[model samples]
Target chain A: MSEIFVKDRELVMPGDVLAKSIDILPGNGTYRDGEEIISKVIGLVKLKERFISVIPLSGKYIPKPGDRVIGVIEDVQPTFWNVNINSPYLGLLLLGEAVREYVDVTKTDISKYYDIGEIIYAKVLHVSRSGVVSLSMNDPKAKKLRGGKLVRITPYKVPRVIGREGSMIELIKEKTNCNIIVGQNGVIWIKGMNEGLATRAILLIEKESHITGLTQKVSKLLEEGDKK
Target chain B: MKKGKPERLIIDGKRLDGRDLEEFREMEAKIKVIKSADGSAMFRFGNTIAIAAVYGPRPMFPKHLQNPERAVINLRYNMVPFSTEDRVRPGVSRRSIEISKILKEAIAETVFTEEFPRTVIDIYIEMIQADGTTRCAALNAASLALADAGVPMKDLIAACSAGKVDGHIVLDVNGKEDNYGEVDMPVAMIPRENKVVLLQMDGLLTKEEFEKCLQLAKKGCMQVYKLQKECIKNTYKQIAEGDENV
Candidate 1:
């Protein structure tokens, strides 16, 4: 039997390291001092700064207090919209949450607030214990997008598109000169770019969303275009 | 799966629409189709493509998890971020977890735990695309996974959903029907015993509506059970036949 030691001194989950490297595949929490393949994300852990944890992708979405999201309107009533937050709990966008204004009840038209198929930019306001969520877009920061084009990728790919602390997206913006906002719900909004660059950027994000070493991959791919 | 927004109407004795109160969309399933999983299956209920796979009845190491009574069943229910028109995230969401839990419970009900007490059964289900009635498709797919694993069960658990849309109870509501429909009910049943193992409904439903939906969902489950059995026998038969020649 072969055994390895954990040299990074970082504790990780079994699934995560298994996904990245296999020196530990037939093993766990074990690492070799040298010749051990470096791991990307450690699934989920309870370690401090010295160690990392990995969270395997599951199909449930629980709205956090301050996460940026993109969602689609599943239905609309006279004063509210039912949003499929892509979570187990459906999201609700009240009439007042859609804009920054006070309207007389006599002149209010709920349909005018949000259409059934429209996409809305939002932030999670409150998640209730009874399995309901309140969403808000009225804050100055929550812009009601009408001019940007939206594209979607898998939710698991968000970390990739955003890159480590927004580095990946920043690189794309710098290279293509495009203003892009990626939603936690897997929606990407692109503005102020030609169709070619925008398409290229979207494809790049989509292709490398779940993969590690994506930044270099994008750079290499884009560099090929320059040479051609 | 049916389409379009559900609208409440009282036209004739008919359901504002022409569908009988008990009609179901086309349901079909296929198994051992995907090359990726150790064991895989695909189930289509109308436009929905629900896939399931079985992996690792192997040891869940750590030298700490080998139970003597039953194997741990780690279930995952995933809606491909593209399962609908809107792209979804490829990771776990709360709803996915809930679905996975329900699936695990449902399969646990029928599986003989003592048979493989030290092993772990991992059943994974992915909703490839949702037209409507995914719960039922998911049940069918999960059953196929258990079968693919060659795990013995008292019976294959079958599931289906029935709901009231536009004031009419329709069997196996499609995606459009679910969004706009007033009531959505999902049920998992064991046909051999005519027993209901899992039942849930969302939206509004009167007592009578709930009863009607329950009966309809059970009926749908039985029909699905037949298909599930056939799918299993056929898949194994095919595999055995192929191995024989090889």
Candidate 2:
């Protein structure tokens, strides 16, 4: 008989046997040992249709090719900008990819577009084997962020803050009536009226991310705020 | 006048602290104690307290040291000046260097370094209080911090110390017992795997007595393992309960 050793959302320690039987496969945060799959980190066990994976509670951001991220320009070079993507590896943003229009490199200074310590939203272009991260601002959504409160949470909690298919975030925006951008790297940019409420909601989500039925609780909190 | 060692360490099968031969000191552990680090924990074994912080699985600096095939593990074990009565120096000592190397080697056994090639894992252990068996306490704290940092590992490692004090096999020797004990052995292992990653000895013991001490140490480690698992679980449990502050 196919058996699952752990239930959904149950906390598991390293070396814990999460599942058994040859039909079951191990996914992220889990590894296969013989016929049994084991958890390799302290996390919650999530059971999919045919595979079991553990979702880690805390970790540094690991850049993937398709991830959208927020970064601060650390240095401006002739051809590229060295950006701090809040990871150990520095992200490179090429000048040619920064804007859709062409500029004379000799005449126009690159600092006008991206100065040091300025924050911007960009997409990960490529992550090399050597840990070099290439970022691109060529996407229409990518642009400079200004006059907004930026908060960082655990990168793993970004998914929870976003909720299911933008439902939770949409609720926060509607409740607070604010513009909020949640980055894949866990950096959030908030602006407009009631930015504090949006920040507080994001903080609540990050703090209570392990809880089940979190969406309902957040909805209740937002409804209460509507009265006041 | 020189202080003489105590003659009797065990009374009625209980050690000086009223603990049985196989009993461990009161222990407490908590994860995410430090907000700045990638992962951090505070562990206390009796009066001995150690806080460990873990950083990386990130990029390695000093270009030449980066490993293309696996991540590098670096450990630093240091005792604060006020941790002991004598007020030790602030910098690393010869003793600290040796402990750091051993702790690194033991923790490296459990970490899956190949998963993040060219990255580095740095573990820092600071002894806030020193009674006895500080290295063992530090090892326990470091393992918890590593797991808290979400490092891929084979298992969580637990460590304990056992020694022959006044001809009796005792678990978790205190500062006084360590000064008077005839043999001291500290051991660390992966409880689930039943694999020993660290075993070091100072002083002498007969063959039969050594075996007995090792068995007692393993039992002590198992007890510590329970606490370590609970510590990690509690951190997540609080979050699950919708607690705003964990």
Best-matching candidate per lDDT: 2
Off by over 4 Å in 1: A1-228, B1-19, B236-246
Model 2 chain A weakest lDDT span, ten residues long:
A219-228
Q: Note the chain A TM-score of all models in turn.
A: 0.68, 0.91
lDDT of 1 by residue, B1-246 (tens): 454654553246454335566766667778666554545678898788898987745444554776656677888888887778767878988888888888788878876655444556778888888877786788788777665544545566789888887777778777766777688888998775577888888898888878888888888887887777676545534543333221
> Which number leads on DockQ?
2
Clashes of 1: 29
lDDT of 2 by residue, B1-246 (tens): 246776687777888788887788899999989988989999998999999999987778887998988899989999999998778899989999999999999998999988777878999999999989999999999999999998989899999999998889889988878888888899999998889999999999999999999999999999999999998887887767655465
Off by over 4 Å in 2: A103-108, A223-228, B1-4, B242-245
TM-score: model 1 vs. ground truth? 0.48
Error of 1 at B96 (Å): 0.6
